[model samples]
Target: MASNFAAPMKVIAAAFEESTGHRVRLAFGSSGKIFAQVSNGAPFDIFLSADQAKPHALLNAGLAEPGSAFTYAIGRLVLWSPVTGRVSDGPGALREGGYRKLALANPRLAPYGAAAVQVLGSLELVETTRSRWVQGENISQAFQFVATGNAELGFVALSQVMKEGRIARGSGWVVPSSMHRPIRQDAVLLEQGAENPAARALLAFLRSPRSAALIESHGYQLPVSEE
Candidate 1:
């Protein structure tokens, strides 16, 4: 659904294909975009959303089977800067300091972006940092803004920054979940004949213990899911 899901899901999907000999094709994008596609008849058999809202929309629209959707992960946000070995410890840094361009995902579309807004507001940086704010369509793009130095720094997903089994390269702060609402990312099995053998295999394999373990290893927390 965002940068956070990309690497972890890639590793797990590859391993699943290796073990089960069941190949999987992936579709990745902003949760909002995916949701729109799914609603308008995207060919995908399953929807893994960045937040619960989109999947719930699918379920409510009868695009997904009742009770077939559930929270798959809990996302965490981060404050990342591209500079190597530099870390932005916390929200306070954004406030009592100066940065010309700061990036964040569009809060209206991305839950992590919304949380970043909350963290800033809680720290009283909204009014101070508002003028400096720049928006990405998704968290990955937001991370890219900071990663490529397009912006001085930005709010990103913790999972995206995790590299070589580490959280981030540059100076950044892993925002505590308590600072914002839980990002309950959900996955739904589509009801529009998406229940083909391949789809079932993919779904089953995603919830497999090995897959869950791998995703967790990449710094994403798997939900107590019944998917």
Candidate 2:
């Protein structure tokens, strides 16, 4: 699972375990890192990527079961700050330019980071803000950087600071989807788990209405077809 999905996946996995008696052991990290590990024969049964590209790459490389990959969630990006009004105006706050450090995941290792880069480019702040960056290896760490006041504000997954359509703490501005490509997160059955009933069952659970609602409560959108 990608680190951005950490909170929701944990809850979903626990619910699946309780209802089906199937224990799910999950490992979360940047999609890029996990993709490399999967390609290198990491012993993972499933791949829940932060983008469609990685899963598609795995399928093309014969690392994942053909036809098993599909979008599970559409992630939202947000400009956030732990301070009450730091980011209330969204990109406007960024444009105001008083903050010393801005945190974001490393674009090479996380889809959210790639989106953050896109957002910066769209806002025309790339050159001006690039020097103040505090890059995290993954989105979780980026969020942590802001939450701990290491960075005044940063780009993070909306799911990290939201629950049930509300910001859980601090302030945030949901980035407009038009600013970047849709964050279509995909999930696939790895070749290693093609014959694993538990893996298959877990995948089925992700597509269930139960999981769909649970996913939305964490501030993610379902694929249009599911919606």
Candidate 3:
């Protein structure tokens, strides 16, 4: 959850730890990558993915409990840049700048990347920035590319920069949901994780009101409770 779920997870973990004194560790990566790791018998108790596909893969592979998978949040796309003077107020900013490199996670692996492509297509900016594009293996790496200035700007999860209901002091545009599909981030308990109580605690806390508030503070829409 740390890429799509990164900011929200941090905020929620703080409240969870403060209230229960139990720590939750974060491992951020593309759902595909993490799912692959978990399938190989990795000791991960809980998985929060940028899409439902990875969790579905886990279910198919007999690695995750079928009944336990649930959506945690909705991810939004952003056109973000680390440049001092370049400002992005919409998806059109890609064409309006002097940027030579824009990074994104692999669309085939990360839902955020798919949203980025959809935004570019909607704005007709994909061809303009195609040659200058940088692809990260995953969403976390894509964010890092822009964050560290390795790429002038990148499509990243809003969850990365928004915390406590405020955006960080960097120029970017939050793409409307009409621009792309909703990033229905899904979570599941792994068979490898059933032995770990921390994972269960983490999942329960994620659904609690306190954690829901923290997730919203980081720019992700709070999940509708599962019936």
**How many clashes does each candidate structure show, in the order listed?**
6, 0, 4
After TM-score superposition, the amount by which residue 93's alpha carbon in candidate 3 deviates from its true location, in angstroms, is 1.7
The predicted structure with the larger TM-score, 1 or 2, is: 2
- lDDT of model number 2: 0.93
For residues 43-118, write the lDDT of model 1, one tens digit per residue.
8787888888888888889898788776767887888887854454576668656678889999998898898899
List the RMSD of every prediction in angstroms: 1.9, 1.1, 2.2
Q: What is the TM-score of each candidate against the true structure?
A: 0.92, 0.96, 0.89
- Model 1 segments beyond 4 Å from truth? 1-3, 224-227
User: In candidate 1, how many Å is residue 81 off?
Assistant: 0.8
Model 2 C-alpha lDDT per residue in residues 7-66, reported as the tens digit of each score? 999999999999999999999988888999999999999999999999999999999999
Q: What residue pairs are clashing in model 3?
A: 1-5, 1-6, 2-6, 45-193
Ranking of all predicted structures according to TM-score, beginning with the best and ending with the worst: 2, 1, 3
Name the top TM-score candidate. Answer: 2
- Clash count for candidate 2 is 0
Candidate 1 backbone collisions, by pair: 86-170, 86-171, 87-171, 87-172, 88-171, 88-172
